[model samples]
Target: MEFRRPGPTPTPWSYWLIRLLFKFVLKIFYGTIVVENTHLIPEDGFPCIVCANHSNSLTDALLLVTSIPSKKRKMLRLTAKSTQFGKKTFTSWLIENAGTVPIQRKRDFEGQEVDNTEVMHHLMKALEVGDAVCLFPEGFSRYHPTIAPFKTGVARLVSDVLSKNRSHSDFKISILTCSITYMHRQHFRSDVLVTFHEPMVFTPKDNPELLKPVDYNVIRDLTAQMHQQISHGTLDSPSWGLVRTSKLAARIYAPLGTRMSLGDHVRVVRTFLDAFKTVRKKRDQSLVQQEDDQHNIDPSFISELETDLKAYQDQLEKCGIKDDRIRREILPRRTIIYRMILRLTWASFLLIISMPGLLLSLPVYVVTFYAVRNFKKTGPVFDTYDEIAQYKLIYGLISGVAVWVIGVLATLPFVLITSLLIPALMWMTLRWIEDAVSSFRSFTALGRLFLIGKDTLKEMYDQRKELHGRIMDMAIALDLPANPEEYFAQAGGKQKGRVQGLWESKAKYFSIRRRRKRDWNETLRLYDKVDYPDDDSEI
Candidate 1:
């Protein structure tokens, strides 16, 4: 038997259909235009590898393919887990029909050392012919804010492709780093950000042996930069500065102003500049002390810092006090009422969907609930209502299957209908239960919808706290002026007494330091100089 090809075919209809579906799905789900950097992709024929951070479910891959301009999107083939096609006829049909390439999950097969040599050979052949392949270098989804460490498979594939096609000097093999961010994964009408970084071009003289190790570094650096871009929405220095300044301004001015004017703008700008200077000075001091605390700090500290920084930036954007008076008079009441209504609507929808499932599977539901309750009493595996529902469906399906089989053995004609109807009903009921629970939890005042708004505010507070801590620690380490405002005052030689007093009051209320004992100017200068080191330099 011939196996299906694991890539997109040259069928125009398939390409258009996929694109149309993607546009529809993304619009409905994300609520905003699918912004992309198609210009970064090569216009001419070139062998390329598109590597994206996997955050969403299968939606990540679909977004990549459909978002790309038609010409280039047609030739793209995505490698998926081979097991997706195993023993599931309908799923297999979808995969094969969509022109997906199925990659074996296991390296070893049937007591034999499966080298994947043929797979690489076939992939290289496609690359040589100017086709693009998409891969998730992160291997699996963590659903966390940061990208995971990349797998070595991509490195190996690139190395093998380059080695085999040495004669094709014009064969341009590059890695395109893609970033995807979602406001909410399962929610309808959310926001998503997709960005494509410029490809990293490789030359023939570049060491293949070093490729894997160096590739890891390249990808990590690229991802870090991309992550920052996705979070802040720009990579240009001036734009980044503006973003930082805007955030700082929002936090300082939101409670003070109701509208923007020349005076308000100046005030916000000055506040931002002061905060940026303070943050920079503190960062410098921390680097000096990093040596001493290197052993004590966790290896994941940088990742955590990045995540915190992003959160702070997000809060700043959201808190831009367009008009302080208007916000005070209007926002609070409107926001609270809106949230309450949203919660109720969500709860009602959940209850509507779940009631039928519960009624239909009453027996199975009762048994599973008691079993889960007993199990949790022992340890607590199924802690959530969703987990309990999942268990109910599993048990229900097993029992239904047993009944269907017995019915089939007793009467062959009824077997077919029983097998089909039993599983279908169980599946539908399980889905209904899940949706209902989710809706109820989301819409009820006690559920996520109500808490999410509060959580967002709390997150903003936490981010500020983290930023303040980092600044203080850096200041103490660098021996800078203990107070951030003092450092600013001294550097700028302008001691606006009122400005200092205002900052002092805010810091005191927030539990942030009023003074430190370090000078971080030199450290900040040093960090700026070395932040983007030469590509040849060791990380």
Candidate 2:
């Protein structure tokens, strides 16, 4: 089915303002937000139902609203819980104006009669106007690596629309499925990938009787199809442990000395997971396939790879080293020293200029930091890791705005100048902090060069190289692409890294790594045991 590419659509000033704020917040929150296949979003089509797997709470919706690029920004009428409405707060006002469609759930309002017929009408009205309507088919947000069971809301919407418009000769609608993947959800400044998959078209005008009633079976089947489409764009593993292991394997499998974009990282991880699933399925079912088959994989090879990876991880932890540090291009002692000095010098200069702003911004920064830090202690218990970031975002925004307003009023005589200068200073202060942290890490890594014995460093290097070469060989034997970065780049994906020259490589090596600084407790929390099977679990 062909979908007409969406052109500029008229959007309200309020929606655009909100979207602008969302874009700014997302940019600050995530180090990089890469959007892929934006062409698949039918922004100007007949009743478009956009569905996404709700994995990261409000952040998922915000990404959908702001990440995708379009010639004309189309306001996505989000379907939110009815409980979210009927409030006099800022959130309610924001959602109300942002074109949110509220659906009533009986569980939310106990002993009170709730109806969604009106909600359905509101959604239908919005769609009939050629507006894109987005809803999380999974119903609620989750931190699980896999998609949740769909709530049938999406299926019912599609079926109802198609059924209602069956008589119109030119009637049609498109369902755009999206998937959001986060490298590290709880941490700030991590990478996020938003993938918009091809749209599925439903044309009841050609065959009126082809439309089915929105019954249990029909909704279930449609939801399953939607789930499959969204799943295609996600990295689904049995548990977080498998996810981490797969990422580790991907890092080792990737070409040495090459930095991968998060998109490539996720794709490579999926490649490993796909191989694991295939090998495990064959082993569990006792399937006998010819060795010449392209899909055929050796179970022993995969087992050995996993075992070696675990050992490599243990070794790195024991050595207090990171995989990136080991695989990074080695530089001479003088070059390292110069680079360290340069970074430290730049950091010191930045800190001097940023001190005044940092002090002025200190109250807001410290309050937001400590508030979010002690949130779980004083606030309600968080259910998922995803909630942490969302809370931080909300707290930061509210506190920042509130504090800025108060500061401006207190210094009314210089309101105009201070208001403009304060925000810029705050921004400068944030950049300085990031640079300071990066410089500190570079300094530490450089200092370690002088402290570590040459023999021990060489041994660690040799072990890592051996493991990396073995993974490369196994990947080749399995007929996986040798260079994933190039493969993705060839497919029109953009990656950020230094080019192939000695000086350029050194510059890229010193570039700030976006990896989260994990303490011992954070590490333990991440690798906590989950009692799930190794096999792929159904969504």
By lDDT, the best candidate is: 2
Instruction: Point out where model 2 deviates above 4 Å.
Output: 1-13, 70-73, 105-114, 206-210, 214-219, 255-259, 277-294, 328-346, 377-382, 410-416, 448-452, 477-479, 484-539
Error of 1 at 460 (Å): 13
lDDT by residue for model 1 (466-535), tens: 5656644533444434554433434422212122456664554322111110111001011111112122
Model 1 residue 108 lDDT score: 21
| Number of the top TM-score candidate | 2
TM-score of each: 0.46, 0.81
Residue-pair clashes per prediction, in order, are: 16, 0
Residue 71, model 1, lDDT: 66
The TM-score that candidate 2 achieves is 0.81
* Residues 192-288, model 2: lDDT tens digits: 7788888888777653433664457766777788898787677875566556666677766764322445566677777777666656566567752
Off by over 4 Å in 1: 1-9, 86-90, 107-114, 205-539
Model 1 per-residue lDDT at 30: 41
